[model samples]
Target: MRAAVYRRPGPAAEVLEVVELEPPEPGPGQVRVRIVTSGINPTDWKTRAGYAGRMPDGFQVPHHDGAGVVDAVGSGVAGLAAGQRVWLYLAAFDNRYGTAAEYAVVPASRAVPLPDDASDDLGACLGVPALTAAHCLGGNPEALKGQTVLVAGGAGAVGHYAIELAKHAGARVVATVSSDEKRALAEGAGADLVVRYTDADAARRIRDFANHVDRVVEVAIAANLDLDMAVLGSSGTIAVYAAEGELALPVGEFMKANTTLAFVLLYGLSPGQLADAIRWTSGALAVGALSALPVIPYPLEQVAAAHDRAAQGIVGKVVLRIAGN
Candidate 1:
C-alpha cells in the first residue's frame, strides 16, 4: 500500500512523505477499506503540525475522513461486507494507518455505508465537518425544527455543514460571513439569511430576520461573543466548536437569559453523542438533504500541498484522490 506518513511533526513539506507499506488487515470489529478519496480537515494539518501533542504512534498516516470500499471485514463485524462503499470517520484516531493510503483499517462503527446517490467526493467530505455540524446543531433533528439557528463562519467547512444541517432539520438558518464569496456559499447551502458579521448592524440584521436566534453553531466564540449575545434568544444554546484565546463569560447576562454554552470537540464526543451524530448525518445523506461544498482535488502524491491548502482555510473541501475509481 502507498501511504503518506509523517515520522515527526513539523511543516507539511518538511514532514509529510509518500511511502510504500504492507496494507493492514482488519482486526476484530474492524474493517479494511480500499480508499478512493481522502479528505483533509483542519485537524489533519494541525495534528501533523503538532498542535495536538506528539503523535500517538511513532509514525502517522494523517487523515480522519475518507470515502472508500470495504476491502475486508473483521471477525464479529456485522452489516458490512467486502466491496461495500463506505465513508469513514476518525480513521486515524489511535491508528497509524489512515485513509491517506490506498488502504486503511478502522473500527466498523467508523465506516458508514454511503448512499448510492452520494458520490465518493461528497462522502469524503462528510466525516469530521458534517459530524461536528450535526453534533453542534444538538444531534436531534426534531428538536431544531421551526427554530432559528445562527451559524458563525458559514463559509468554513464546519460552518458550511452547519448551515445545511440546520436547514435540513427544518430550522431557519442565519449565517454570518465576512465576504461576499462566503455569503454566496452560505446562501447556496440554504441558509435563510446571510449577514456580514463585520457589518455595523449585523446583530440588528440577524434579529430583524429571525426575531432571535434559538441556537448558535459558533466557530469563534471569543471573537463573536458580543454578536452572538446580542441576537440569542432567552434560554437559547450556543454550541461552540472552535475558539482562540480565553473567553470571559458575561455571567450576569447569561444567568438572566438562562443561556446554555455547549462546547463541541469531535474527538472528545462521548460514544452516545458520536452515534447520534452519525445517525443523523446518515439519515440526512439518505434523504439527499446534505450537499457538499465545492471540492478541490489533489492526487495522493500531493498530500502535503493539500494539507497546506486546508490549513490556509480554503473555501471548499480539499480531498486527495487515492484511487481511480
Candidate 2:
C-alpha cells in the first residue's frame, strides 16, 4: 500500500510524503477499505500541525473522510463483508491511519453503506463537514422545523449542507454569503433567502423575509454575532461550529431574548449524537437532499498538493484519488 506519511508536524509540503507500506489488515470489529477518494478537511491539516499534541508515535496518515470498498472485514464485525461499497468518517480522528492511502482500517461503525446512486465524489464529503452540519443544526433536525433558520457562510462545505439539511427538516432557511456566486450556490442548495454579508441591511433583509429565525447555524460566530443576535427570535439558539477568535457576547441582550449559544465539533460528538447525524445525513444523501460541493481532485501521490490547496482556502472540496474503481 502507498500512503502519505508525516513523521512530524509542519507545512504540508515539508511534512507530507508518499511512501510504500505493507497493506494493513482490519483489527477486531474493524474493516479494511480499498480507498477510492480521500477527502481533506481543515481538521486533517490542523492535526498534522499538532493541534492535538499527543499524536500517534509512528507515521500518521492524515484524512478522516473517504469512500471505498470493503477489502476485508475483521472478526466480530457484523453486517459487513468484502466488496461492499462504503463511505468512512472520522477514520483517523483517534487513530494513526486514515484514508490518505491505498487502504485504511477503521471501526466497522464508521463505514456507512453508500447507495448506488451516491457517487464517490459525494461520499467523500460526508465525514467532517456534513456530519458537523447535521450536529450543528441540533441532533433532532425536525424539532424546530417549519420555523426559520439562519446559516452563516453559505459558501462553505458545512454551510452548504446546513442549508440543505435545514431545508430537508422543513425549515425556511436564510443563508449569508460574501459574493454573488456564493449566494447562487446557497440558493441552489435550497436556501429560501440568500443575503450578502456585506450589505448594510443584511439583518433587516433576513428579518423581513423570515421575521425572526428560530435557530442560527453559524460558521464564523464570533464575527457574525451581531447579525445573529439581531435576527434570532426569542428563545432561539445559535449553534456555532467554527469561529475566528474569542467571542464576547452581549449578555444582557441575549439574556433578555432567552437566546442560547451552543457549540459542536464532529470529532467530539457523543455516540447518540453521532448516530443521529449519521442517520439524518445518510438519509439526506440517499434522497439527494444534500448537494456536494465542487471537488478538486489530486492523486494519492499528490496528497501534499491537496493539503496546500485546502490550507489556501480553495472554494471547492479538495480530494485525493487513492485508488480507481
Candidate 3:
C-alpha cells in the first residue's frame, strides 16, 4: 500500500511523504477496509504537526475519516462481510493505522454500513465534522423541540453540519459568519438568522438575533466567549468544539449566569455519543434532510496541498479520492 508516512512532526509537506508500506490485516474485533475516499480535517494537520503530543516510534499515517468497501473481517466480527460499503471514524486514535492509504484496519465499532444511495466521497467526509455536529447538538433519541440554538462560524466544516443537524432536530438556528458570502451558505443550511461576526458590535448583534438562545454550538470559544455568554439564556448549554486561541474565560460572568459548558473533542467522544451521532447522521442522510456533501477534492499524493488549502480557511471539506468511488 502507498501511504502518507510522517516520521516526525513539522510542516505537513516537510514531514509527510508517500511511501510504500505493508497493507494491514484485520485483527480480532476489527475490519480491513480498502479505502475509496479519505477526508482531510483540521485534526489531520494538527496531528501531522504534533499538536496533540509527541510522535510515536513508527511512521504514522494521517486522517481519521474514510469511506471504503470491507475487504475482510476479523474474528468475532459478525453481521458484516466482504464488499459491504462502510464509513469509519476514530481511525488512528491511539493504536490503529488511519485512512490515508490503500487499506486500513479499525475496530468494527468505528465502521458503520453506508447506505447504497450515499456517495463514497460524501460518506468519507461525514465522520469527524458531522459527528461533531450531531454530538454537540445533544444527539438524544428525542428531538430538540422549540429550542433556540446559535452556531458560530456556521459556514465552516463542522459549523455547516451543526446548522443542519440542529435545524433537523427542531431547533431555531442563528448562525454567525465573518463575511457576506457565507450568509447565504449558513441560511441555506437552515439557520433562521445569520449574523456577521466581524461587525464592531458582534456580541450585541448576536443577542439581538435570538432573544433567548438555549444553546450555542461554538467553534472559537476563546474568541467568542464574551458573545456566547452575553447571548446564552440562563441554564443554557454552550457546546464548544474549538477554542482556537488562548484567551481566558470570564469565569465570573458565566458563573453569575449559571451557564453550563460542554467542551467537546471529537476523538475523545464516548461510545454512546459516537453511536448516537452515527444513527442521527444515517437517518438524516436517508431522509435527504441533510444537504449533499460540499467537497474540495484532492489526489492522494497532494495531501499536503489539501491541508494547506484547508488551513487557509473558508474552504469546505477536502477529500482525497484514494481509490475508485
Candidate 4:
C-alpha cells in the first residue's frame, strides 16, 4: 500500500513523501478501508506544520477524514460490513495510520455509513467541518427553530455546513463574508441574508435584517467580537469554534444582555458531546441536507501540493484521489 508519511513537522514540500508500506490489518472493533478520497482540513495542515504538537508516532499519515469501501471488518463490529461504503472521522486522532493511504485501519465506530446517493467526494468532506459545525450549532435540532443564527466566515468549510445545518433546523440564517464571491457561496448554502463584514454598517445591516441574532457561530472570535456583540439578541449565545490569543470579556455588557460565550473545540468534546454531533451530522447527511464545498483534487503522489493548497485557506475543500472511480 502506498502512503504519504512525514517523519518531522515542516513545510509540506520538505516533509510529505509518498511511499509503499504493507496494508494494515484491522484489529478487534476496527475496520480496514480501501480509501477512495482523503479530505484535508486546517487542522491537518496545522498538525503537519507542528502547530498542534509532535507526531504521535515515528511517522504520521495526515488527514482525519475520508471516504472508502470497507475491505475488512474486525471481530465484534456488527453494524458495518465488508464492501460497505463509509466516511471516516478522526482516523488519525491517536493512530499512526490516517486516510492519506491506499488503506487505513480505524475504529469501527468512526466509520459512518454513507448513503448511496451521496458522492464519495461529499463523504470525504464530512468528518471535521460537518462535525465541528454540528457541535457549534448545539445538540438539539429544535433548539434553533424559529431563531436567527449568524455565521461568521460563511464561505469557510465549517461555516458552509453551519449555514446548511442551521437552515435544516428551521433557523433564519445570516452569514458574514468578506467578498462578493464568498457572499454568493454563503447565499448558495441557504443563508437567508449575506452581509459583507467589511462594510462599515455591517452590524447594522445584520441587526436590521434579523432584529436580533439568537446565536452566533463564530470562526474568528477575536476579530468579529464587536460586530457579533452588536447584533446578538438578549440571552443569545456566541458559540466560538476558533480564536487566537486571549479575550478581554466586556463583563458589564454581557451582564446587561445576559449573554453567554461558549467555546467549541472538536478535540476537547466529551464522548457524549461527540456522539451527539456525529448523530446529528449523520441524520443531516441521510436526508441530503448536507452539501460539500467545491473540491480541489490531487493524486496521492502530490500530497504535498494538496497540503500546501489546503494551508492557503482556499474556499474549496482539498482532497486526495486515492482510488479511481
Models 1 onward score TM values of 0.98, 0.97, 0.93, 0.98
Off by over 4 Å in 4: none
Give the alpha carbon lDDT tens digit for every residue of 1-325 in model 3: 8888788888878987878888898999999999999988888888788887877568788889999999999999987899999988878787548898889899998888888888887778788889999988888626676888889998887888888887777788999998877887898888898988777777676667668788889988877777788788998889998857576867887788888889899877778888899888888877766764578888888988877777776447888888443
- C-alpha lDDT score of every prediction, in listed order: 0.92, 0.88, 0.83, 0.92
RMSD (CA, angstroms), candidate 3: 2.0
1 or 3: which has the higher lDDT?
1
- Specify the highest-lDDT model's number: 1
The deviation in Å at residue 320 for candidate 3 is 0.9
Better of 2 and 4 by lDDT: 4
What is the lDDT, from 0 to 100, of the residue 189 in candidate 4? 93
lDDT of 4: 0.92
Question: Predictions ranked by TM-score, top down?
Answer: 1, 4, 2, 3
lDDT of 1 at 177: 94
- Candidate 4, residues 201-280, lDDT tens digits: the string is 99888878988999999998888989999999999999998868888888999999999999988888888988988888
Better of 1 and 4 by TM-score: 1
Off by over 4 Å in 3: 141-143, 200-209
lDDT tens digits, residues 1-325, model 2? 8999899888888999999999887899999999999899998988887776755568898999999999999999998889999999999977777999989999999999988888888899878898998888886777847888899988889998888888888889999999888888888899999998788999999988988999899988878888998899999999998757787878999889999998887777889999999998987888878767888999988888888888887786999987555
Clash pairs detected, candidate 3: none
